[model samples]
Target: MALSLSARLPSCSSSVFEKAHKLTTQPPILPFPSNLAACGCTLLPASMGVARRRRQVVGAVEEQHNQTSVLAPKQSPSYSSSKLVLVIGASGGVGQLVVASLLSRNIKTRLLLRDPSKAISLFGLQDENTLEVREGDTRNQNDLDPTIFDGVTHIICCTGTTAFPSKRWDGDNTPERVDWEGIRNLVLALPPTLERLVLVSSIGVTKYNVLPWSIMNLFGVLKFKKMGEDFVRSSVVPFTIIRAGRLTDGPYTSYDLNTLLKATAGKRRAVILSQGDKLVGEVSRLVVAEACIQALDLECTKRKIYEINSVEI
Candidate 1:
């Protein structure tokens, strides 16, 4: 049966980098990065970064021994069932957080990347069954084999290149190709049974030719992204298009934080989700990633499109 993508969507159950999406058969997970469970707590590599924090945690635990047994009181988290998520652009800012949050939630994840080593470097070693890595650029169809989506129930595509001419555009990985052609190719190859495809797009997609948006759309990044969104809408699969504002902060470092992922955005401000594509502002990569995760599990957001930005308190 053909499913029409929703034009307007109600807010999904959400929070400040916290919120859980239910519904799925338990599969696997991609541990959130933070040692404290905010994603990136295990960052900076162990060289000069560990001893200080380790001391803090250990000291705190010891000092609080008369009361809360910090380590002992913490029990292993029981996880709910999850659908398999195929994440593209896994090394990108939002992509990493999504992968990390999925892992933290014990949800199975597969990453399609141009460089698989980046996954290991950014996310560290993970159980192959729970976190699988494949190498393929969205711009290359030959690399996107049918086997890649074999068990993928949900897909989050955050792949994108620079907006203008730069080193990042080398090898024809330009907006026209990466944002438009790449997305078109991916939608064309998606399996029929796919539950949802959440695409990370930009804010000015609708007004690319207008004033401020036109400035950013010099090289047609917004235009191409809109093209991608349109293609997905036209496709048979269910879909959600998350149009994000100018991104502010960076992607959180990922880690094996095996538990229900919450506050994945850390100390970021409140996230504001909007409809009608009227929102214009900056948002953290964390909020974008969190919203994407929420949309995947929200029935109201299915086949819907949304624009999101963050506010500082």
Candidate 2:
């Protein structure tokens, strides 16, 4: 029952990951910087057990990357040989970053997309073992065949649409369909042994009927998203729900996987994590992407719902 609230964040940066690595390797004593201290922010320390688990997770990725780098210096390194991650909505803003990060870590990834050709255009060609693409629509239960979940130990679902009507809703992909029904269908079809399901949700769901949130929920997006979250919670599958703020940063729709891998957070390098859904602001798609990847292996994140946001240092 871990719940959290966070503010908006900028894009992703390698420094962020580097700092995270350092946190795991060193003693878990994180002190707020002078600027953050002036803002009256506080930092929390992870228990030794959590630190060890974090270290193992980060160490494994680095070790795998080192080994693969030596063998294939010219190609992207494949690090995690045991985990197969299935990413839904891999073509979207956050989803693209998630896939790029996963591939960069050398983790095996499978994508469920309506147009398989998009995978080719965005990610370019790849070894089937490293990046596999499957054509399917979550709105259709039949589209979520059992085979689609084969070998998929983890799932990061970033499927979403605009709060208001737009071209994305062309195929009856409304909030009711995409957010609620789509999520319900996917959850029902998931394999019983799936390790985790990280769902990207919106922040105002709990108070969708209240003022500003009500305005955004004009078309029921927040309401449907809450429904989706509830369904996932009721299931027995291990899950982590990341409630994001108004998303900022690029959708990076036109960028290729290489460009995506190099994406940065610019000035937004600081992240804030908290409990309760009390914060509200925009968040970088990159930050959300990184959060999903990190949550996959962090034991503390299991069966928890966290709201993530970022601020300038």
**Which one is best on TM-score?**
2
In Å, residue 32's CA in model 1 sits off its true spot by 18
Q: Candidate 2, which segments miss by more than 4 Å at Cα?
A: 1-78
Clashing residue pairs in candidate 2 (N, C-alpha, C atoms within 3 angstroms): 7-309, 8-282, 8-310, 9-310, 11-265, 78-106, 79-106
lDDT of 2 at 148: 94
Cand. 2 Cα-lDDT:
0.70
Worst 10 residues of 2 by lDDT: 1-10
Q: Write the per-residue lDDT of candidate 1 for residues 111-183, one digit (tens) a residue.
A: 9988887777777777898889988877888888999999899999998888879998888989999999999
Error of 1 at 126 (Å): 0.7
lDDT of each: 0.65, 0.70
**Shift in Å, residue 47, candidate 2:** 21
Q: What does candidate 2's lDDT look like per residue over 210-310, in tens digits? A: 99899999999999999999999999989988888888764558446555644544433344443356557666676778778877776556787776665
- Candidate 2 Cα deviation (angstroms), residue 49: 30
